[model samples]
Target chain A: MSPSSPSFAVEFDEINQEIVLRGTMRVRSPEEMTDATDLIRRSFGHGGHLVYVNIKRLTHLNMTAFRCIADVLTEACLADPQRRIVIVASSVIAWSAPLFETLASAQPNLSVEIYDSAFYPGQTFVEDESFIPILRTQTKMTWRHEREILPRHGMKEGMAIADICCGIGDFATLIKRQFNPTRLIALDHSKKSLEYARRVAAEFGLNSIEYTYGDASQMLLADNQFDFVTCRHSLQIFDRPDILLRELYRICKPGGRVYITNEKNSHCLGEPHSESIRWTYDEVAKLFSHFDMDVEMGPKSRRLLTDAGFDTIKVESFMVTNLDGDPRDFADVIEAWENVYAGQMAVRRGDSPDFIRRFRQGFKDHVLAALHPKGYAGWPIWAASGRKPF
Target chain B: MIERQVSPEPGAFEQMASLTLDTALFRSEFHLCDRVSEYLADIVAQSHEDPARYANFSSQLINEMIEFSFRSAVPTGQIDFRLLKNEERVRVSIEFAPVSDHQPDWLANDTSAIANGHPAVGDLWGLADAIRVNLHTEEHKENHVTLMADFALLEAVR
Candidate 1:
């Protein structure tokens, strides 16, 4: 009942046939648990069949809270037997949705719906409003990168290919269209991202591809299954990149190809913020070498491939122009770059927020200018392809 | 290495106890203790008012109390197989130490007593047995526990 207290607040609109429940429903507190239970009862009592849980402001719910909410929703659905519970939240909550969905699915009556607010207008940052278009542009650019590199490595139709960390299914769709591979497995850890990829592939009517959720380093696939393995802009996430690259090597058939693309270590661009960028690139390069895999570093990543135990490695670089004339696209890119810079600065400071604001702002400004048109708003994207020796 | 009897100071016990409580280094063990404590506390309070509830809860409370004490002394870390000299029973030691400067006073005192006890006569074999049971169930194949045992020794040097 206390407005300041952390408890679930429910509102039922009978005419609209909607039930909205908001607030932090964590089980760490008894009040929150009681409020959550009450919300479910009140919503169901009002003949409000369609339920919409707005979790935009609800932050920090533990596994216990998740279970409690899931149980209440499940019980309510069983009573009605035809009601659906819709969850609307930011894309940050996408990872947690699978856990909730799994819990809800335990009961036959309940159907869980998760809607990412980014796909909706006005909810996300003004700059991020154009994310779909930017993602589409990036997807297209990745395909172009793949096209230029794949054929150079002698990739052909009917070959078994694995696309590791296939974001938005861009490379998978591209390979399906270009090479028409015999069996293409597109694997990514993010199920929501994979869902988008799946829908896009389904729309394109591509059926040869299979999707799997897994870590690239410890793929569940059988050894020596893939003729070629392709990864784009995903090598940075691996805590042990060497292990993943070695696994990629093991999976490829003798004489099969491996194609990898990453944003070139910006030290080659001679940007003002290139020191940190160079360190990240060096760390990645070290991992590649540790695996005894050949690598081509710099504006051309073909050298990385050559050093990574590959006999023949080729490198190519291209620039993606964000010249859609939409200031929003430029702003989005700037925001993303700012986030990256902020994260780096935080890590350097051991996650302390005591640094001078002026210094941080100056770094942000330098990065934005270097990335924008005034200083050549183009990043050196590298593509390298190499053939594994028999 | 020479056999040494290190007498931990009173302040050391206080520090260890504070650390244990603050960091919950023995959270699993403490949770079992808490359950036993709560049940016993309720029964004791209720016995003053109503004896029937106390009588009904006594058996369960006793079992939980025994289990709790046993877990507190045993190492919850990785299980290593070893044969005790001339004995058919296997001897397993699961080592744990409070990582924080704050641990519960009673628990810390109990731990110190057990650690510094005479080699021939152990203070609490029942407590050690409970810990072994918990460790056997919880310890993974690659379990590793890095204890801050040197902290008190270093402080003594200072």
Candidate 2:
């Protein structure tokens, strides 16, 4: 929730085209971006552009809150390429500041410099900013036609289904509403996320969809109990994707269908990837095929499923497009690709500081080019399904 | 620089502790102590030159404390670690106040130096520069043990 009163102060230098933010900024607080947007509107006057943003005294900044701030700053700075942001952080924040430099570099327009202590004219300093507004827009994405994916699985009126590692149970809730499943189990490792899923399920007045805390490596549930099982956009990130696939097979009844879907490799705009994202699907298929369940990576990965011994298998790809130029829809697509995908990859990869600077610059240019006048953007989901032999 | 108090009153059981980390709420019975020790090692080493080499000593002290407490089945143990900046030293004290009719048998006869008693006998003796134990047997049957270790700045440790 927002503070009863602002914990921040903004001083705009209209003559010099500068905005100096003073005081504490609780980054993830409910009204963080709202306050920033107000400040930006008031300061930038026309295009949210500033010659400088002096965040030298904004104490109590953290990585979690930094993410919330960075998203906002990236978009705002995109307004003018020549703008600059300078952050003067205390020694306490030195360890995390250089990485913050990496994030600020994500903005193609803005030039950034950071200093562990306040910079004198001859010395140097860096930039940071905004994510809450983006979070609000992303959650309200355009709905998908589940029939484009579900009926192919023979989902009938009373069949059982499971979504493992179901983050917040978005897909599970959608399937429950569309397919009228008699029983559904939503499992994830995070108890906090599961609690949110339960609350969402209750809000929709959904019963019979049980929420359980479980690990992907070992689901502490009965084997061969589910008629259909699914895990989406999760395998590649697992420490052991192979073990997780086998676990999926262990819980599927004979003749029941199970599918795993992961994104195409080189996710940043170089398409025409192979069936295997990190490893050959044939190898994955061959290794786990012994478990008595047929496996496939995605719809495009037919050869691997056939090689794995599934005589009959189905494959399909669905393109998700924006809805009617809604700013929120465009923002949602931008959020997924920019913040969720590219941003995380940058942090995790641990690239050299200069390399990060160049990479973030290039990434921003690439994404801004892809985004449309109306925020029009689209991506495809490749899904392949195979039934365990009867 | 933080002075954290975990639970109960300060004078409740006579605690001269500076920072108290409360693991009472979380169940790290399987690995909590290990994680705390690991984290402490990182913080304790920040000012030292051979931080990595001199690391894990704090972990050793905490591990023994956890072992002794869990063995005695003491409920809700508290960890208080203090920084003696003037002396360039750190002290970690683990206490389980009013541990019922008796304390852990190994601890009752244990030395303030704490050597050759429990299975993890070598940890404290090998790591700590000094060790001491204080048992509050008057009102609360409390067992508080403290370990003081000298860590060098880049010059001193080297």
Model 2 stretches with alpha carbons more than 4 Å out: A1-145, A265-311, A323-327, A340-345, A361-371, A374-376, B1-158
Provide per-model DockQ scores: 0.01, 0.02
For model 2 the local lDDT of residue A90 reads 32
Model 1: how large is the Cα RMSD against the reference? 24.7
DockQ of 2: 0.02
Q: Pick the candidate with the highest DockQ.
A: 2
Q: Which number leads on lDDT?
A: 1
Give candidate 1 regions above 4 Å deviation: A1-137, A268-308, A321-331, A340-375, B1-158
lDDT of 1 by residue, A97-207 (tens): 444455455666554565543321211221232334455556664454557667877788899999987756777888898899988888765555667777888888985
Report the number of clashing residue pairs per model: 26, 16
lDDT against true structure, model 1: 0.47
TM-score of each: 0.40, 0.40
- Give per-residue lDDT, candidate 1, residue B49: 18
Worst 10 residues of 2 chain A by lDDT: A120-129
